[model samples]
Target: MPLGQRPGDKSDARYCGVEVLDFPAGEDLPAVLNHSLASAFDFILVPLVDPNYRPAPGSVLPVSASDLILGPAQWSNHVVGKISEWIDLDSEDERLRLDSELTLKQEIAWASHVSLQACVLPAPRRSFCGNYARVVNQILQGLTNMHLWLRLPLEKSEPMDDDLDKIKNNSHTSEIVDSWELWNSFRLLCDHSSQLCVALDILSTLPSINSLARWFGEPVRAAILQTEAFLTNAKGYPCLSKRHQSLLTGFFKHSVQVIISGRSNHNVFPVSEGVLSGDESYAEDSRVRHALTPYLEYIAYLYRKMDPLPEQERIEINYRDFLQSPLQPLMDNLEAQTYETFEKDVVKYTQYRRAVAKALVDRVADDAVSTTRTVLMVVGAGRGPLVRASLQAAEETGRKLKVYAVEKILTLLLLFIV
Candidate 1:
């Protein structure tokens, strides 16, 4: 049952705010209730009027009623944009599934003006048409303009039910390639947003899980994009093999999300216990299963990693950071030749040089009075990328720039000049 309602109350949802938002007992109560984010709701799902039920609101979400669904499991009140899939739109055109303009209009016309945080589509993973790339590009544009998020499926077999029923094929192949391809696609969209996340249904068996769990190379993992995907169907959580469960458990322990589906009015967890109550108290009892069965199960035993405070940085310290300090040690007796060798061998030096040039260019662009030509001196111009970037920036901002490229080994400098 919902938290504050009586046993016979018709409006069954507890955190939905339909009752309060629609028919508040008092005026100040709504403000008082939603004031402290520490006690706010996730999202307030509203009804869409007739003739335009599947309206999309894009990023014009309500400030008081909604906040960005931060870390999924770690919110005070977690509400997301909701559209009733059960509603009969009376149209056979499934073009909304992959049509970018259709998608955009739906998003912009969202009846509730809710930010389209993460859109849930009907099994676009298993069968996207020829227009998927364009659809993805359209979404990528929204990410920058309004910080929209898309919840593309990793694998889906639901739509195959009609054909499968004729042949009665309940079996599934390990869509490992699909997961990899789709994951890679989401990652390749260029990180305008913080992370490129896909929402994967959790009903699949271990082979697919293992494929995804195996280490993606460091360069791929360390790309500007973050692969912070989410998992759904916590009801299927116990189905994973112990090893695969451990793998998912470890991932969610970091700032990841798990969404559970259940009846609207069922008691998921105690209102007093807090939103993400994955703690030690319920480990040995039926309470954990019972709670999770209703979207309230937080198996803290499975996820042992601690989340840092909002004020603190995410402390993902690795062993390499221990060996190599950020501040390079200046050996008192260092030779210039040794320094030159080290500089030449450093793979990141080129990138660092380009970044420095970009920063200098940005700084010069910001300055109003310093109109004299900005002299960019690349100390170790091993390759010409830094010089090119400087020239490009100067051109873009209509600023005068003079480049001075210096290399200790004149052979490298001369070779480049030639």
Candidate 2:
């Protein structure tokens, strides 16, 4: 289920997910999923394969669970596959690097078989990851429907500043690589594939506001909120600091989903404690609530507390990101529907009236207000909306005015004159 029903928001940010730290052993995925859903989470990020498994001759892929354990829709919708973290294609050991590459491919193929919509790639281990970029680029070429979200850390800029100073003071010091620079290099190597996106690992302390603003323009699909980033309130509940809360709010606005990660710090008990109170028979029903439910609830609270979308914003929400062909007024006739939509903008017309009134008041002195009339010419007036605004402005300012409109389109001129 969604976190909450926001009136104008139809984005994925409404859904909150939890990361499953340990592998769900022995086909226990369904049980884990049910617990998370019952605890009010919308999805779960689970490991696709066992972390300990390494590729070998005649060895089968060690997956957490079989593909048939869940339906195709369940795998594609409620679950996001996590690539095994141990794969290090950039390692110096030739055997380890080859094994890591084989394992990475096998896991991705398994995820594709299960019809998973997306998979989160592990963060690159080294700064100079040319081999890593090459392999991911190969995978992207054949990938059809699924998207590869490259995970990157949102490191605080304090260390970056210190590193910058070291570079200036000493020629021997190597400057630290920025996360954005890493992403840029990887994506450029991949030729900027549309399927490539990012999942940011948000830490406890954030970077400078200017440094943080760079990500708002990037293709950020999810923000992994670590549990350690939260602070325990007086009531022993998990809550984010002011900066984290603001960052989360910005993510919500940009349609980036939130995934709660790390061990639960607050000692908040399972959500089923209250419902199963005094019922010993059903107490240990083997279906316990999720420990991270409190964090999800707090995130939902932040989402619901946001102000409702304005009516005008709601009406135009459908046209948010898609591109439309630019209208050439000189080459084409103005459509009636376009005029109708433009005239409905009450605020635009109000501003026009105010500007006209100010100009009238400034030009006509108090003594000349009754004797002399100011001639106002509205060039390229479309159906005389501006003409009406000018007349209304003159009436309000108590100044005499003469109005003339110039329009090239005969159809528009006739409509306004009539």
Candidate 3:
């Protein structure tokens, strides 16, 4: 039950004490094998060959050809060093150099055989352990037969098959098998299996079905069905409980429906008559409704969750009051003469006001240069003619004036401003 124990470790009942093997340097190792055996008390605890270590020719044992094929190249020197130390090796650099050379030649031969054998083997059989082991051992045997070793100590008494058989029949046995199957099938279903593993691993760690669905893929529904079948038939293994299985299945089914609905071209208003009428029955079908329900519910849930924030209200202003505000009174006082004239001579008011405004403009412009002026005004200005005249006069006189002008008759003033 301890983590890192090999799958076969629990099968034996006779508790043979653990042994630690040491490979010493500079003694003809093969000649000194008897001494090593004697030290083991006839129970040899062979150390795992550090994958980095290259074994002596005679020490090599036969292994599956497929297993012997070099795996992915390890680019890290630190990892190579650790492996070297574990195998009682001299240096990682030396081992790596030798491995690279040997692997190139061995891989070519392995590849040729693998290609030929692949053609002969059935798809399912190619995935089987027996076939895989045969291919793996061929490459390993070619490299060095000494890589294989028994890790467990040998029993002084003869081993019995019955106890081993009983252990093989235990509840955890199929779990061990399933783990192996899952690991071996990994590359074949990389996209799907990896995604499923990530989703399940995350769910195991965080227990959130909703978050898990975010990463679940298109094949999730099919995978869940397959997983359910495996759990049902997998005797003696602690697979997912029925309740968990049902929940996972329901979740995947719901997710699939949600995705389908999201990708569907259902519209509130169909552009063409044929478009809406073509699949009316399909749209109203019970199956379609069932599939879309979860998606609709989820959307509604999100909408409800976001409906409580405060909203801004725009302030409304009245133009009539704005025109008569405090700023307007100052403007009106500056143009009081124009207002007084307009109220008096209503008929000839426009022409008389134009002349008065022009004169006022001239006076303001002349005075602008004589003082640091704060305000300049043109009174009795008709249609703002005096304002234009004042600006022209100020330009010619080389003076800076802050000009404000008023025109008699509201219509004329509006026209002038526009």
Candidate 4:
């Protein structure tokens, strides 16, 4: 279920997810998934393969559970696959590097086999990740439906002062090394493939406000909220700080799904008597509260607290963050459909008519309304919406007017004297 229902809101941001820390082995993924869904989480970010397994010759991949455990629809709709974190393609050892690449590919194949919508790749080990980008680019060439999200920390460390004495003494001052640069580099290398996206790991401390704002323009699919990032409330319930709340609101506006990660810090609810850890037989119902239920509840509270989206904004919500190439009206004429679309904005034309009326009233004095004439010019007047507005304004103000409509693309320039 979504956090809350707002009229005209169909954004994915309404959904919240939890990151599964432990592997659900022995065909137990269904029970875990059921419990999480019952706890009100819309989805789960789960490991596709066991974390302990390393690639070996002729050895089958140790997936968490058989593909039959969950139906195709459940896998695609409710699960986000997590690639193994141990795979580091940039490692110095050749054996480790080969194994890492193979494992990454195998896990991705398994995710695709299950028809998972998206998979989160592990963060780059060091600053330089050219090899990582190359492998991902190769994978992207063949993928038809699945999207790959490159996970990275929201901010990295950069040395502010390079004084040798302070550096040697371990007292050198350091500042954030804007992670956007890292993402920018990776995306550029991959030719900015649309299938590639970002999943930011939000820690306890956020970067400067201006630095943080840079992410709003990027293709951020999810924000992984660490459990430690939550501050304890007055009543000991989980809550976010003011800055965190503001950032979360921004994310919600951009349709970025939030995933609660890490161990449960607040003991807001007591565990039932018979439930045991790693027990698949336990009832997967609402009666058994999940450990991360408090955090999820707080997230839902934040979501519900948001004001409903404005009606006009809801109309344009589909194109909110869409990227499009610039159009050149001077070089080529716009299609008739384009002109019709803009002319259909009744609200815009109404405002234009009102403004023109006010200007006409001010230009011609009340005493000279019938005696003096006002001259109005509408530049680039495509389809004459403004021309009509000017004529209406002249009638409303009872002022004699001479109007000129100039459109460069059109062969004829219209002149109207009223």
lDDT to native, each model:
0.37, 0.84, 0.30, 0.85
The candidate scoring highest on lDDT is 4
- Quote the lDDT for 197 in model 2: 93
Ranking the candidates on TM-score from highest down gives 4, 2, 1, 3
Residue-wise lDDT of candidate 4 within 222-263, one digit each (tens)?
999999999998999999999999999999999999998988
CA RMSD (A), model 3: 32.5
Q: lDDT score, residue 263, model 4?
A: 81
- lDDT per residue for candidate 3 within 207-250, as digits (tens), equals 23453344333222111111112221233322344444444444
**Candidate 3: worst-modelled 10 consecutive residues by lDDT:** 74-83
lDDT of 3 at 384: 58
Q: How well does candidate 4 score on lDDT at residue 400? A: 89
Query: How many clashes would you count in candidate 3?
Result: 20
Best by TM-score: 4
TM-score of candidate 3 versus the correct structure, residues matched by position: 0.16
TM-scores for every candidate against the unseen true structure? 0.38, 0.79, 0.16, 0.82
Error of 2 at 100 (Å): 3.4
